[model samples]
Target: MGEVTEYVAGLHEPARSSIEGVFFIAREVVPDAEEGRSYGMPALRYAGKPLLAVMEAKAHIGLYPFSPAVIDAAADLLEGFDRTKGTVRFTPEHPLPEEAVRRLVSLRRDEIDAAIGRRRA
Candidate 1:
């Protein structure tokens, strides 16, 4: 198993399932995303850029897309979830909707693509 899969597999109940759910949605959205570490957290990387990272905290789960702009773009869907400039915290009891996760991965993928395009231009 990969580091990410191993990481998730090593977690305890509920947390494991919760992170797994996010990983499932992420894979569907970006099948080419690679398993890697970003900011010391296991993350999904697309086009050589950080796509997203999901981690379980003592009190809540954190979804880090690494872009404050992306968070702002999905602010409506994130209502009621505790968040900061770079992280969204949710609980397994109120896990992030698949749609939100999809949007985040898609947006970040798009951003990475755009940046690469710009660099080539």
Candidate 2:
């Protein structure tokens, strides 16, 4: 299994499913995203850049897209979630909406593409 899958599998319930859900939505958004690590967290990398990372923290599940700008752009969709400049903290009881997750991955993927001088035709 991929490292991300392994990491997810090793977690307990709720967190396991919650984190897995974000990764699932992310994979659909960026089908070419590869399993990798970015800044010590297992992440989905697109165009060789950190696309997204979801981890279980003591208080919440944290989603890191590696871009403060992307988080800012999606602020409307992220209402009610605890957010930092670069991290969105959520819980399984109030899991991230699928739409929000999709937007996050898409925006991050676009950012990566732009930075790497690659355009999707």
The CA lDDT at 80 in model 1 is 87
lDDT of 1 by residue, 1-121 (tens): 7768888988998999999999889999889999998899999888888899999899999999999988988888899899999999999999998888899888877788888884322
Tell me the tens digit of each residue's lDDT in model 2 across 35-85.
999999999998889999999999999999999999999999999999999
After TM-score superposition, the amount by which residue 91's alpha carbon in candidate 1 deviates from its true location, in angstroms, is 0.6
Once superposed on the true structure, which residue ranges of model 1 sit more than 4 Å away at CA?
A: 118-121
Give me the displacement of residue 88 in model 1, in angstroms: 0.6
Best by lDDT: 2
TM per candidate comes to: 0.94, 0.98
TM-score of 1: 0.94
Q: Which 10 consecutive positions of candidate 2 have the poorest summed lDDT?
A: 1-10
Off by over 4 Å in 2: none
